[model samples]
Target chain A: MAASGEEVRNMQVILKDYVAGFPKESDMNVKTGSIKLKLAEDESSDSAVLVKNLYLSCDPYMRGRMTNSPVDDPDFSPFTPGSPIVGHGVAENLRNSSKFTLLMCPFPYYTGILGMPGMTAYFGFYQVCSPKKGERVYISAASGAVGQLVGQFAKLMGCYVVGSAGSKEKVELLKSKFGFDDAFNYKEEHDLVAALKRYFPEGIDIYFENVGGKMLDAVLLNMRFHGRIAACGMISQYNLQQPEGIQNITTVVFKRIRLEGFIIFDYFDQYPKFLDFVLPYIREGKIVYVEDITEGLERGPSALIGLFSGRNVGKQVVKVTNE
Target chain B: MAASGEEVRNMQVILKDYVAGFPKESDMNVKTGSIKLKLAEDESSDSAVLVKNLYLSCDPYMRGRMTNSPVDDPDFSPFTPGSPIVGHGVAENLRNSSKFTLLMCPFPYYTGILGMPGMTAYFGFYQVCSPKKGERVYISAASGAVGQLVGQFAKLMGCYVVGSAGSKEKVELLKSKFGFDDAFNYKEEHDLVAALKRYFPEGIDIYFENVGGKMLDAVLLNMRFHGRIAACGMISQYNLQQPEGIQNITTVVFKRIRLEGFIIFDYFDQYPKFLDFVLPYIREGKIVYVEDITEGLERGPSALIGLFSGRNVGKQVVKVTNE
Candidate 1:
């Protein structure tokens, strides 16, 4: 294999078959392959992002993609077996469609906050919740990539924001760096509902639903009339064979809550708008981002597994290459 | 009872006690009650409608009010155990607050199609659903008071509307009188989902939800993307100790269906607009309203109980008095 210039090998991790239950690291195997730097000779389409795949995002929804059932599936096209699973990544554009063979100048995993997690925090909060100033906002998984941005955005919008995280360190990050009005470690809290009541005596007006199941049930009972719930992901229920049953959906009727689920791809038109809003905040240091980068593509499997186990501190990403 | 100028005794059906599970005919006992002709002959601040109860509407929502725990219930306010139960009615203003009570006249049963039920059909459809012309609209309980009005409104909006009722007679009324594009007897149809698919090949754009449970599950399956479901009532599940388990709620995420429950009292400002829109239709012969009037206050228990079993056709109403 030639290491430099036009003739370079592309190594990819391919799924051997469809998954059942939580995916294991052994379910996927890395295969060594070569590309001629052009889709005409190697890949299928010129429109594709030809990247030296770096940090692949491991989200709970990926579990749904691994299943083969046609019934009750999300709108996302199902993942094909024995194919390289594609996801949000920070990567180097190794070759251009314009040239027969293009050389790479890489800052691997350098795509800005406009990536999947960023757009998720942006549109999921603003558009789905339609939050107004001074409205009380509550977020779960507060120190993660999406949660951190959501808290910051809520603060920017002049809202009273509270967050619940997994650890004390994450709780502090939420309160200090993210400027959350209040933060709690959900792990330590004995009664989740009482904790919410203590923080918000008046009640929550908007809930960013990152974790579903019992937390959702508690949130439902506590939600004020006309409250909105942006159901971004249900992390707590993703790995289970049977999702946690919710007993309080009737509250949606009584409270007049608008609970809607959304995918970022459905709102791609807002990407430019999202970039405009978040970029300035990033440059001025008004918005701070934390990424837990695990080096090398071979190590991507463990990093992904870390997401489900809550082992990563911030954004869990893998850096494939550096040039 | 002492009479003034035209003061006739007002007869009412008072709730004997709070109901347990499904209410029977013996649950409520009719009682005679009298209101003073002129506000309290001495005091001055009473300007409410002194209606001569003509046709008292029996609705499924009233069952919610009959429970002692209604205050804790989200859908309705609780009924006083020993007081008169309030509902929609078609009545004459027997004693206008500005005028003295006439000795020959008495206020009628304050329940019928024109009272709360009319407003329920009005705002619940137009405002909550925000229906557009030529859209496909589906309404359940089509021959009932609210359903009848909803079907007519959809027809007026140039929509292709279909309605489902329990009996064949109600189905005919939906087609002939209510002007629905099609009507089906859900009790006779083995496959509701298949029936809906046959009726709406393109899928339903708007669903005015009156009867929930299984029909709601079926509607969810056939709803178009971004479809709107105005959840006015879940009549089918009202009497059950626990609401039926739904298997297809996840469809709300895929189809982007907005299923919202609403109360008419929340949008009271639209009352004048409702009258303005409906009155012309009533006079022009474009609209038709059917009422099932049962005579005597003693029969109120049976009339109200009939609503749960789908025994009454058109609007099930009790005729309390003729002044």
Candidate 2:
């Protein structure tokens, strides 16, 4: 740990203003601020832990928070202008100032597989979809943080999994690395409904929805009887001023399909339980995570903005410090 | 019973062709045909029962069957040109022919409170919505067959029930006859979302969706946290070539709402249990059903077509025979 009276430069990516339409790199600015290494005399010792954020997670749902209204989630406050944007990050404990030292021990894994995205995939796939052995699962945005984990988890459960991504590299990674049964570049498909029908001839039983809009509309057309859709996020619709309308939603009635939307905040209590289920897979090399990481905090604005354009191949992470 | 050799004139309604947009009265033609009163020699006594049709039900969902694809439901076959349209009806058994006489004993109640609409309201409200006592419930198409029953059932469950109709008379009937806590003529409301907010300031806990399109979009904005939406039918979209898109569907995620669609065919096994729960309510006049009877089967075409324009006052029924 640094000396008690030492001063440190804290670099952060701050929001310029409330974003409209697609977010541009210029919407964020990297600013330098100073912080004292030592705790104040009056500060509570048992409640707080000093952390040096090492890896900042760049996720699609963060785009929703950039907007002034944060229209999709009423509980989420918008990013304050000229302030450091808050998000999930892998942080290293600098000082033990809390009684719950055990809780702070796992801070390193808080941005990746054992973090918000991991819990999202766990609760979304197992709890929401209720997958059975040999059931067919289809995932959108499958090369991203949550999707990659969902695909691997589904495979571990002995289910057939197919994924759709935006680029050829991501598609190849899904099949070659993640062990997906089939993978497709959704950008190349002229007709998404036809593409989904071609891939899932028997129809999809469980759909892990990440990218919404046209994808959701097509998935609705290809759902099997009593199919379940775990609506984790709608990254495709988040940037649009007026989100696309779903035309074939009536199929929900005929197929007896259940489409439910969820956020990871509600499933935080299941973190310990999720780790128990996933740790073995990670340790045995049965599960793998690919991250698209950029060096230095200066590249944070572009790294975060690149998510909307499908520029990142895997989990986009901004590496702030080596320690 | 009529003599064995007697030939009776059976008035039938036949579709001219698969309808495109709105169905017109001319799309269906009423014609008279003759049927032998007695069963054929090859017809098994245990397999068939002869009955006289008394009342024919005219429902909004039938509009879906008028299309070429009937994309919503594959089980429902489109009306074949020059063939009599088949639907749920009140019938009187003339001959015992079958050993299962007890099952056919209640045929008279098949077109009203004990039939399709009854089970729809029962399962959609009780099973899907899972309403709690003192919760706020809202019903669309309030004066229609299933809607009226749903309103009454919610009231019986000790819920604060409100309903929306298309006309002043229907709105009055919802509040006075059906005992809805409050009623509104939606056609008079300039802004549906504002109107719903005015009625349900605390937000709606259950929304029995009978009409889709703009109403559904508006309802999404007014739903309370963890609200349940029983998508019984989308009457507004049935006749249109393109169904209206719902813009505020992401609210499902923010509010943690569960929107479920159901058809009564899936709940037939629960019919006996439904009867046990509902029969007493009807006996004591705790539940009352209103029928808009159009005399003669010749009026069936006009009565069925009238559903699109909100022409029928209640459960539109064609009184084909008195006895």
lDDT of each: 0.76, 0.85
Show model 1 residue runs off by greater than 4 Å: A1-7, A41-50, A70-75, A95-112, A187-195, A240-242, B1-10, B33-38, B41-51, B70-75, B90-114, B188-195
> Candidate 1: how many backbone clashes?
19
Complex DockQ per candidate: 0.33, 0.68
Q: How large is the C-alpha RMSD of every model relative to the true structure? A: 4.9, 3.0
lDDT of 1 at A62: 67
lDDT of 1 by residue, A168-229 (tens): 88899899888999999988888988989999888899999888877887897788878888
Taking the tens digit of each residue's C-alpha lDDT, what string does model 1 give over B15-108?
Answer: 8888877899888877776565654443333454445556666778788788665343344788888788887665556445343332222222
**Residue A262 displacement in candidate 2 (angstroms):** 0.6
Report how far off residue B186 is in candidate 1 (Å).
3.2
lDDT of 2 by residue, A150-236 (tens): 999999899999999999999999999999999999999999999999999999999999988999999999998888888888888
